[model samples]
Target: MIEEFVREKILNTYAKRTTKSKELWEAARKVIPGGAGSGFRYYEPYPIFLKRGSGSRVWDVDGNEYLDYCMSFGALIAGHAHPKIVEAVKEQLEKGSMYGIPHEKTAEYVKELLRRFTAMDMFRLTNSGTEGTMHALRLARAHTGKDKIVKIEGCYHGAHDYLLVSVFPPLSKAGPRWAPTLYVHGEGIPLLTVKNTLVAPYNDVEAMETLFRKHEGEIAALIMEPVPMNMGLVLPKQGYLKDIRKLTEEYNILLIFDEVKTGIRIAPGGACEYYGVDPDIVVLGKAIAGGFSAGAFGGKEDIFSNIYPLGHAVHAGTYNANPVAVTAGLTCLKHVMTTHAQSQMNDLGEDLASGVKAAVEDTGFEAQVPHIGPSGTVYFTDVEVVDYRTASTYDKKKNWEFWFSLLNHGVLTPPGLLEGGEQWLVSAAHQKETIEKALVITESALREIK
Candidate 1:
């Protein structure tokens, strides 16, 4: 009955407000494989084709406006089509978009990044987070001369084969809580790739230590998201990160912090600074380019000295440091994303989390909102989600109803909770009034769900 009611509401609302989006999806499917550019963009029934976005709002093809909390999967920390980013891109457009040659803005941007993230002594740019993690892994392997790598279960580094294992494995196939089997996330990933990559439970230091000892000298590095955003923003329990740092050092293994999601959004220095633990290498992306396509891997001088043209671990890309992206990034870092702005966003996020929790309690729903900085996840379960296994146990059906309810009520969230739980992002443009309105909508949605 609940599913029926939710489906009816969604279908009716979608039909009334997204007729043009439906037509666009039909046309898009003729050319685009899934009627969308990315797999995650597609949802059941159809996705509402976006027309434009500005500040904290977006309009669909059929002219339906929504308070966008997805925020391009937490990439647009400065919010959609921010004026500073727009002006920077416009200025760069007159000069050039891409210059297969080195540009001064690239140097300036790197300097700015280094200034913000003091732990990184040297860095290199990539077109995407995948490239950054790929290069970081290669550098780690080259530096340690080890073939194996350990990654926390449920942490998504990217779509690369090396990090794809055990991302969202079924519990039946997933081994033990402590020792998880390296189950490949998708097909076409070779068995050999799975063999070289090891899995460790998130927030489990003893399990990590055991795994490290088991792998011994063969392991190259242990890469992880310090905050584990992919698993619905799971935080590092008290000493989890510190323990991991100590274990890596004791085992003579390198530590790589995949800050692709947390970087620049959580803090200027990212989780490294927020948690006060610096890894040997860090991979960053998303807001780093001010909503443009960009990624970067940086670390101590000794570690980066092993990269191409310096020590031989080749990392090459044609569009690594495009002028437009560099300009936008520089502008965002220098003018827009100041310490004050970040603090404001963090406070807004906390407020939203508290509001959602209150709504859930008032509505008498079995849910929990776990948040950090400007990002959070709504777990439709009573249990606390500390790791992937707990995250997976969430009531996905109820969660979907909650998501559709929000959509029907003119709020935009991720369509589905992939490996991670249902995530919501708060941007700098999200004001107190906007948050209050969203809370009202959330309470209404929770009431309907109940």
Candidate 2:
């Protein structure tokens, strides 16, 4: 009864304040598939449509301003309309957006990426993270002459078919503890694609080895988010990443770290630098472009030698390194997201995560906030979220109530119904003041819930 009352109250407040957004959503549903550009952007009570954003804040179409924690799903590390990013985009805009040809900034951008990633010798740019992982997997298959791939159960590696298996699958159908069944994320994926993909539980080295021994030479590579953000930022157990790296090497399977979310956000070198575990290939996106659409996959020169004009594995895109996106990315890496900026954001992220954890405790909420660097998630689960099965045990109704209350209180989390799998990010633009503001709102919302 209390849960129902709290939920109704929050929903009423949201509906009252976001009438304009509601109307826009109603109109958008007619034209767009899910009333938003992406499936994740739409939610139960209609997603908020933002007009514009500045440092640390976004104004909704309904005129409500929020301390934007979504940060474009952790892509906007420099924050919304960051002055440096804006200037870079404007300057590149004058030069030209797309050239169907090579430009100077593309090489400059890759050089900076190579410096940061350290493990990657050569790099190729793509339009989105999906393309990066897609090409990286294809390169793996081509290089190893293997057909199958292994992916973490809950880790998401973009929209491609190869790595799309078992992301957020129902616990009932997810099979056993160590060995999980291959459950396709959605329909339209052919059985051949599903058959070629293998699933292993995250953080379980034994399970990973089990799959490796079971598949042996058939597996091309094992792709994973070193610290998976898709399942709401589950950190690898101590030595988990190192063990995986060693096992992959022993088994002759290439290790691909999908650092698309973690690349620039966790640290300058991302999980590779943070954890000191080097993989065969590093897939990067999100914060690398500082809000622009960009992705890159790179590793040892010999591996990437398979891509295009050089070798058999084909890779081509007209907008692969569109000058504008590269300019934004270049400026972000060299200027905005410097070592100091990364440290500051990490400090702020720690504060935000601490505050959220405190609020949960004070409000007697059974929840956990697992954070690293500039990203964290509020998992309303009693069980510690270590893997997909544990993460799925979270109370969805209570999470919905908590999310709605936070939204009503002017704090925007990631958009979705079951956002237990999503996270809140702190951008470089966020300072102590913005974090304090969010904490106040978070505490108040926590108190309002049961």
Candidate 3:
């Protein structure tokens, strides 16, 4: 890959700087498999340990500063350590951190979410997007009394047993170009589980209609990302989301919008607001708590009531509403609401996409930055990606070349060039000046890539 060849030369220039980061990795490897908390962090070189973040920057343990477009993989919209959020965290800490029962902050946080999604009658808080998607799927199955699910190919909801199928299937072994074989994204996710997942290409409503007919009563829910950003920021074609919502209602299959990445990043109401499609269930995470590890699922309250104690689906957590997260989330959501932050972030997103496209085309290379809401990516080819088949067809050699060149220029993108292309997130903190600087860096880097 491009990183290996570059590592030989790049490491020579930054040898000593990488040493301390290497040492941290060595120590971490003893306790954490992959030397990182999340498997996503296992990159070419050991990942850098972050010491702090403020605004649109992160300071590594080796004291290297970078313009962090990673944004905790699109988690931190308010940026690191916004003073208002810090004050809320401090105040909440003084009142005691973790209480086993419901707290006042939970009500306040829910209210903020309710304001954005007035259609939701109730919601349940969770610790991460993974849990949110997992539980949402469970609730979906319970409500509809079905055993299978339908998801757009290459779309990711979370790392659950059922949803973890076909996220990154190998193109060579993947059956037909149109009907790729269902393979689990990770090991130990049962083949039976994989069998239960119906794969349909994104933006293909006719294909989805065919699947709806094939497995009519077996499908519990149709879960997917509103923008399918994980497959490299492909926006839904006009009427795509609306068609799915309509079909799911017709078939009695629950419609779950996995807005974990798109939620609050697209708008206060998320992709639902952006596309004007109201799903029965919406799974939110990432930016939901302004970069903190927080997640939630809100729907028609009757569906949520299917969970145990009140219903049959079982979900529990030690830190479901831990004060630190709740306080951070409350502050972040409140700020997003007041500032009309999604509009600001969307403006930045458009500028970033436009500037990057202008820069890349000037290099005479077929590259473009595609975006929706506050997030997007620089695909190294001009191909309009809509589904996994198209995304896999892009020239990956040029893509990774651009990736490493950008890294050398001091811009940290998403870990691994594995997502077909890396995603770039625009934060409320990344003002006009920041976008311009990144554009300049992008232009110079594009020249270096070819």
Candidate 4:
């Protein structure tokens, strides 16, 4: 009855406030699948339509302003419409947007990326994280001369068919915890793709080793997010990464750290620097380009030489390293996301996490906030979520109610938080006061839901 009451109350409130968004969703659904461009952008009833954003805040079509903790799913780590990004885009626009030929800024961008990601000796850009991971996997397979690859359960590298297995499998069909059955995330994934992809649980080194031993000399790489953000910000167990690195080396399998969500948001050098374990390749996107559509993959010079114009593996894109994206990314990484900005965002993340933890204790709510640097999420379960299996214990009803309550209170989290696949990101533009305000709103929402 309480859950029903909460849902009804929130739904009614949401419908009244977002009437224009409803109309837009109706129109969009007539043309676009599911009334939104991306599946993650849609929610029950309808999704709110936004007009514009600036500096950690977004305004909806209805003229309602929200403190944007979602930060465009951590893609806007420097915050929306940053002055530096705008200036760079304008300056680059004068020259051109896309050029199929090599440009100076592309080299500079790669150089900058290498400077931060010291583990990477060479780099290449792509249009999105999907392309980066796709290319990275191809490189891995080519370099190792193997077809099969391993993916951690619940880790989402990209929408590519090769790594789309077991992202959010139903526990009933997921088999044992240690060795999970590879459940294709969608219907269109080829059977051959599923056969080539393997599944392993997170935070368990023994299980991974079992998989490695069973399929020795078969796997090309083990692709994973260093801090599994796709499963509501799960943290890696202490020394788990280092052990995985050692294991991969022993088995002669390439380790690909998918840092699309964690690259710029977690640390300057991302998980590689934070964990101090270099993988064979690293895929980066999201915040790396300061909200532009860009992704990159890089590693040792020897491994990267597998790409075309050198080796047989072909990686090419018309929009790859477009001047607009490169200029924006260069500006963001070089000027905006400075050490001071990184420190400020990290401090704000800690503050927000601590505040949420305190709020949970005070409200007697069953929840845990796992955080690192500028990313975290409030899982509505008493258990600390170290992996996808534990993360599944979160009460979906409570999460939906809480998320709706926050939206009603002018705090925007990732829409997919209701489905336990997203996390809140603190941007450099986020001030301590805004974090404090968000905490107050979160506490109120938790109390109401409870």
Candidate 5:
């Protein structure tokens, strides 16, 4: 059983500390569904309503400060209100917010992205990652002339109907391991939408090949997160990406890497550069715009050439390349997020991971902290979490205890919207002292659970 006393104590402390947040939540629920903008921001009790942030810290409505690791769900890699990003946005705002017509910043920003991701010949910008992935899939289907698409079991591309299959299904309804059944993640997703989307186990090349063979020429593309963050930062096993690339080529299937979360955070070129594997299409979002709402997709010239004004495909948006977002993104990529900054952030991530792992061991907790680049997750399990299946075995009650304890002690990780594990993102603004303090808090939380 969960330590009821410990749980109650932490909840009591949190409730007392954030009295203003509770009041705001009650007022917000009348208009906003679930009292929050995104479903991921809510929790069992009420979510903490934030007021403002600067650097690696944030203040809630109650004025309680926290060393923020959530970092806008891993989008603010340069940290909240970084001076460079703030100045860029301010300068752009003074000039203008949006111009429906084309602007010079659009080309300037795309050039910076292309410089990092050399594999992409040309790219198109959208308002968000969802739009980027949606257009990318349409292009893939048009280029290959196929209707079906294959996706990893737990990988999340976006909220679009076509890619929402088998995100986090119950094991009882998940079918088998190798050939998993596709279950619609939520309501409003039509049965016809999921019929053509195939599901395959992550980290299993043979299973992926089997799905390809079974579907044959019907499958147009296989889109997945090179290192899945939605399922708690599950890394691709050794040679897993390379093998998948070969298999896709052999089957004449388009390989699209949905790097929405991993892009710009993992490396300059994202997973393709870190893993040394080139995909047909790469979808980027999050940190690319330095916390602004933005998305981009790029690939070989032949595929994107099929877009409007060139071919028959239709891809258009009024805010396709918003000048404000482009200016902020360009400033972040060209100035703030340099090669040296990425290396420093990565080293900080390693330090945080090691420190947390040591604390777990010292406390005799059956847990593991797996990290890559600047992101990591704390899995409350003894076994190695290779994929979603293993990650699902984590202890939920312990997870809640750990998260609540951290919050009570002034540290903020991701709210428990995702079930498998909890991820902590180290930002460029976090100093070594901040990491040490977080580690100390983690040890205290683990001890309280014990």
Candidate 6:
């Protein structure tokens, strides 16, 4: 019944991809657990298989066009097929892929990153954020000699068991808002993993303080997204970030900022620059390596000393900073810093925030259009989404109407309205006209809901 109102006429993108996707889905079902690569991208009517993407738009196999807000789930800050990145990758591919032997370019890459992030020092790269976070956790445990780790509810770090728990767990079964049940997000997480992680509400320094004291020596690190952008752009209150930093330091707890989404996309220095909160260990992925797969964990010499090739930390991946990925990452990084490109993107993001706010208000709907730099997310409910519990209270029905309506109107966003709100990403490639076009689509979608 709910699906009826959520879906309007057949999405042209879906219609065009139907034949190809049906063939692919049938073949994929026999091997892949899900027909899609990621669970979040799968839609009820099936997902559109992309053929190619331009600056800010993507075309499916059926040749249907969409103004992609997904942006490869916050990866392509340069947009797909960015010329500089393309050239870099092509040049690197001509040289070779991987040697497992470190190259001079690796040091150059590290130096550029060091110049920008400032928080990163002495680091290693991985194939994905999951591997990077997994290794980072291991290092934290090794450094502190502690088994327990503190994480914020509603914030997703990666697919690893340690961080996967308490991600969008059912509130009926969840414990208090201050104290949440350590429920694993999926099937295979061990009982011990849930027991080890202490879930704290995001932005609530009091809850974090209580947990730190309660756990005492057991807690190794307290990691969180600096801006808490997962719950559709929930910003930190004034003094909240500074307080978190102070408390973590006071408790002898290592502060880790999971900047996987906000890394290079938000600014040259990532969210650390955007908010001015420095963390002990900062993890990055997605846009950090252009559109390629890569993740990195870097920190001060003290903490990084616990890792391998330096100390005892064992972190290795087959494709860690392969030449192609390194080239892509370097290209993206340079693009973000060159010509003050982030300033351009941030300005566009401000315009996007204003447009979304005006569109929502024009429809007389209570919503929050939270944004930071080039990243923005739309929330359907008016309730202040401070933590996981409050984040779950969003209006799903209306969100789906807005989501599907936007999709039908030629914009592509992540599906699963029940999971969370639509994450909006505008690239440097997204021009003023593109943003205005998105505003037109978004405004129409909101009017449909009213």
Model 3 clash pairs? 75-291
The clash tally of candidate 6 reads: 2
* Residue 337 lDDT in candidate 1: 89
Q: Number of clashing pairs, model 5?
A: 0
lDDT of each model, Cα atoms only? 0.86, 0.89, 0.79, 0.90, 0.88, 0.80
Question: Ten consecutive residues with minimal summed lDDT in candidate 4?
Answer: 1-10
Q: Considering summed lDDT, which 10 consecutive residues are worst modelled in model 3? A: 4-13
Cα deviation in Å at residue 91, candidate 5? 1.1
Model 5 pairs whose backbones collide: none
lDDT of 6 by residue, 274-371 (tens): 77888989888887888899888888898888887678978887788788888888878875446467788888888988998999989899886777
lDDT computed for candidate 2: 0.89
Give per-model TM-scores: 0.97, 0.97, 0.95, 0.98, 0.97, 0.95
User: Can you tell me which runs of candidate 2 are displaced by over 4 Å?
Assistant: 1-6, 416-420
Model 5 off-target regions past 4 Å?
1-6, 417-422
Cα-based lDDT at residue 18, candidate 1: 80
Runs of candidate 3 with Cα error greater than 4 angstroms are 1-17, 417-421
lDDT value, residue 418 of candidate 6: 38
For each candidate, how many residue pairs have backbone atoms clashing (under 3 Å)?
0, 0, 1, 0, 0, 2
For candidate 1, write residues 1-450 as lDDT tens digits. 334435676667767888898899999999998799987788767789998999999998788889999988878888999998998899889988889998888888999889878888988999889999999999999998998999999888888888988877899999998999888987998898778898999989999989888888999999999988776778778898998999999999999999998889888899888888989999999889888888999999988889878899999988899898888888888888888998999999999999988988888888768888888878877888889888887877777777878888889987764324447888988999999999999998888767
Which candidate number maximizes TM-score?
4
Residues 1-450 of candidate 5 have per-residue lDDT tens digits of 234423778788888999999999999999999899987777767889999999999999898999999898878888999899899899989988989999998998999999988999999998889998999999998898898999988888878999888888898999998988898999998898778899998999999998999999899999999998888878889999999999999999999999888888889899999999999999998889888888999999999888988887888898778888898889889898998999999999999999998999999988867889888888888888888788788777788888888888999999852353347888888989999999999999889877
Q: Across residues 42-119, which tens digit of lDDT does each residue of candidate 2 receive?
A: 777578889999998999998999999988888898999988889879987887778998888889999999999898
**What are the per-model C-alpha RMSD values against the true structure?**
1.7, 1.7, 1.9, 1.5, 1.7, 2.0
Lowest lDDT 10-residue stretch of candidate 1: 1-10
Candidate that would win on lDDT: 4
The better candidate by lDDT, 2 or 4, is 4
Q: Scored by Cα lDDT, where does model 6 land?
A: 0.80
